[model samples]
Target: MEQAAKELFETVEEYFQTREFKQFFHFVDAAIYLAQQIADVAKEIHLLLNKAVAYYQLGDSEVAVKTIRKLQPFERHMTASQRIRYLNTVAAIYHTLDDTAHYYEYLMQAYALATDMNEEIALLFLEGNLGHYYYEMKEYAKSFMHMERCLMYCERLNFEAHEPYIIGRVQYINTSLELGKMAIAEAQFERLEQFPHILTNHHYVLAKGHYYCICGDKQRAYELLAQVIRHDGQHETILSTLYERFLHVAEEVETLEQYVETLETYYHYLGRLKEAQAKKQIDQMKIYLNTELLEEMLWHDPLTKVKNRRYLDEKMPIWLDEQHSFVGLLLFDADHFKQINDCFGHRVGDEVICLMAERARQFFSSESAVVIRYGGDEFVVFYSVKQLEGIEVMLAQFHAHMQQCAFTVKGEVHHVSISIGATVVRANVPIEVLLEEADRALYQSKQQGRNRYTQFQQHA
Candidate 1:
């Protein structure tokens, strides 16, 4: 019966993973029915929660809210993780309903729970949502603060191209532009350009168009905005803003024909925007659902869930091919990791390794830095910096973070450290030679004393 339950749960998980929302709803229904038959309170709650989330995602907010409210009696029975999920789902429902006060209330509750549970991913999602909320409220400074926090988590989790990070980056840029922070917006634009997928994304294109509009490039802005209208005409809020911008630009057109054409396009977008708003009101009564899943194998490390070695191998060549110079590489290994495994068992050792990876992630939480779990207890970080001083500061942070990490085994606390080697790579240098230099420096650090970093000195 346990095996059957396990298989059933796996099937449900696969349905969710594959983004088969309808199938996921059906599976959850079946699971709930079976769980009720077996009188398994925990399993029943779990399935019901899944059902509520699925309903929420399907645009059945009323049903979802009602379903979740039924779980109030069982709230005390939920695990910490399950409770966090429940709170987050409630926050999402409020957000959908445009109930800003309730959204913030539930989100903050979820944030506190996530922090207490050390659930990094959940905290990141909450931060991103908060950022979006503040951005929409026209509180630029507050939005930037939350978006920056989201960006840090995105970097730490190696989720550079993920939806949350992408959205956060766009929001950050938009707010910066609104605040007349042209330099900051330009810098963010460069980073946004690094992801080719952004060019095709409706929100990204709209943000880029706004940036151009702010920078006094009316023609370019109009072209980009047109692309956005073409692709995302159904997005009422975005189209409403785009329509206003179009009208503003149309008034500034030099030629009569240009003015007339722009005005016609503006009217078209306005019509679409109104139609979309009406459809949205109708959708509130009907069900809407779709799913888009990311392929995790390309970038993720299976064990530590950081960027894998393959991500490093694939990404580095692109930079090298582009002749990106002054790139810094840091290769590090856990100090006395084998000794820990021998003394504390492999389970504890694995935990220590994961801890080290997490520390590396925190240390390298910058857009330019790419942290990879090279293999086993060793990790590699590649970062782009014009000056060696920047690399030194990062290395210092890495050392400090390592010193601060604490691991507990059977009520006994243990400290772990890493030995790191660093080297700066030039465009002309072979990738192998760059890696070897970093590896040599790492060996020197270990030989001198672990928990320190050594820089590879280039021979003239």
Candidate 2:
């Protein structure tokens, strides 16, 4: 079989050199078969490039990426700019892998290589990726910078068929919203409907719905939101948009009690909680943040900057409003914080707290999760594991990143481990109730060992 396959590869190579390639009516089957048999990735790449060029002329990038991979590289065959475009595609796959930091690293490399190669097209993709990454990371300045860069370059490249316009539009809306420019966000979102090739166009609708609802256009808000949900039949992205809109709505409107009611009704009618988790977390966080506008500040832990008892009290009220979300809280404390302070002094102790908090913060890289200071030496982390599942995978990758961050104190290097208690907040409970629930989980962590996670159970 090996000898037969080798003979086949040799025949295919000879066929590729024939005049058939020069003919307008090239035999695709012969060319394709020859391309597939190339041994070296580089030669494979040449074969793939021929196919890619063909696929591209056919206007099928999705197929191009897939077919291109089956072929190997051709040394110096493609321009440097072309190679950078290939790298950009590789970076995109990493982005889809859902590790923000790794995604950022690969994208940055692509951008640098593209710039060095003078590939404007590749740079445009890099800029667009950076826009979404920074937005997800909650770094507004970076997001805005990259988004504008993407738009400018895309226009220069005349990428009307690409997603440049739409990605820019969505990035603009998110950047404006984060910066508290609701009006700008609305306008940006309005532009998104007309923008071409946006993967997240439905999100624009939800953003408008949530913005109007929060701005007191209750009728328009509810109607828009309903439209958003209705569009779910046509688009799957609707679920994430609905979940985001619901969270923002929970913070702004009172009738979201009805919003929750409607969603709950649908969930039962549909019989699935898989999509409802994000809505649940948003509802609970809203309750905690809105707990008596004035007293809401009381529950937060100052040192760790997590929700304190006061925060928990406020959050408790809306915990079960959605019949599902009630996000789990990881309440963590540093064991023997006093020992570190006593050995290194108060200054060192403060530094340790900051360091630990910083690491805990990394757990929320995508900004979908909330990490807060519950009180002195106590921190709370609430993860909305809906739009993003696979928490364990995230944690595993996080471990690798953490190894690179060395915390130094008092002319010495000291690493601190935290005890985390994780538990789901029962539905309809207040933030305070959730905290208590999480606290019990925290105790279990301490009992089992100081430096780990323990889940709160039913009735625990």
Candidate 3:
């Protein structure tokens, strides 16, 4: 199954080369199906990521983001390269969404991770992505710097055959043109022509058209650009450039009808572009609402209204992988909860659980920690903190609050107390190890008499 997916991905790459996005999307779907049938998470991540890329390339930014979000739950299964690609793709999608902050944030994350891993191939592509980002931002100097680095990596890695290398060279020429380095642009364009595939690539043709327009060769520019407009008219970006180019070349044309036809086509594409933009906004809003609804239904505890154990399981791997400076894990439960249920009836026991959950939520808040119902009568708090003293103080305040709170059962005043076991550590460790540490401390709390907090101490 994995082999079948791999073969389909290779075909998908060919479809991409031919600019047959619909065919590319179909092959990606086939690969995803194969990956799913085998429960191959790594392959599935790779294929789904490509699917998102196809969506983005086809100008469906909202669906691209929706597809990418579906992979978050499986992120822990991603390989290092896959993770970098995920971040890069996410950054690109955010760029299309006009979210400049997240665009830079995730791009830098991909760069940082690739650098840390010494993944030269990922770095090469990331350099090109950064270059392209700066180019779009009209920061030509910065774009040139990254593009230079990207080309250097391309040479060093012998990656000249790949799309990144080709695109990087194209962007290099575009940046040079923007910076008024006409000589550099000419030299790079000459080098770009050596790639036989560039002859058929609309991007290269568009660049050449722009070059000819700048050089005052209106006839040559019109011919090359006309080809691009004919082949790639569906894309807003391509049409946007063609609109301006055709306007510039309109005066040199033999007949006004030629320019008018191009104008009509551009207006048609603009209308479609606007319609797509509006639909994208609506789709994005729907995705946001559905995401919120899904999380509330899937992650929240029904009775207590806090997060549930499933939520903890989903989040634990992500938190652990982050390798925070200080992590504080706290496990607590209502003392003699079974006895309260047995003696006071399940109804009163239910009230006690609800009251404890309410206090936990109040004390912790969303800012301080993630409070979860690990099981019946058992609650857990995961905290990222600078100091253990802060946790101790919070626990003290939480216990004090519990003491002051009382409820009436059968017209009798009754107080519920909780025993807590906590461990604060500074290293990356498995969740089970942390749980075991907290459990040992909890055992001590129970042994020393309930209604107290115990901190685990690691002996030297």
Best by lDDT: 3
lDDT tens digits by residue: candidate 3, 1-460: 5576668768876876676765665456556655554446787787788778877876688889999998998788889999999999999999988999999999999999999999998899889989988998899999999999999999999988877888889999999998999999999988888888687576677678788877888888877767666666656545466557666776576488876776777678889888877886675445433565467668988667688889888877686677567777888888888999999777567667767877877776586578888888888888777765577787687778766545686579988878889888764767787788999998899999999999898422
RMSD (Å) per prediction: 23.8, 24.8, 18.4
**Worst 10-residue lDDT window, candidate 1:** 286-295
On TM-score, who's better, 1 or 2?
1
- Which regions of candidate 2 fall more than 4 Å away from where they truly are? 1-33, 36-43, 46-79, 160-162, 181-200, 213-219, 234-237, 247-261, 265-460
Ranking by TM-score: 1, 3, 2
Off by over 4 Å in 3: 1-51, 54-59, 73-78, 227-240, 251-258, 265-460
lDDT string, candidate 2, 72-150, tens digits: 3343565565566555555565555455666677678778888777778677778878888888889998888888788
Candidate-wise lDDT, in order: 0.77, 0.59, 0.79
What's the CA error at residue 76 for candidate 1, in Å?
0.9
Ranking by lDDT: 3, 1, 2
Q: List the residue pairs that clash in candidate 3.
A: none
lDDT of 1 at 140: 86
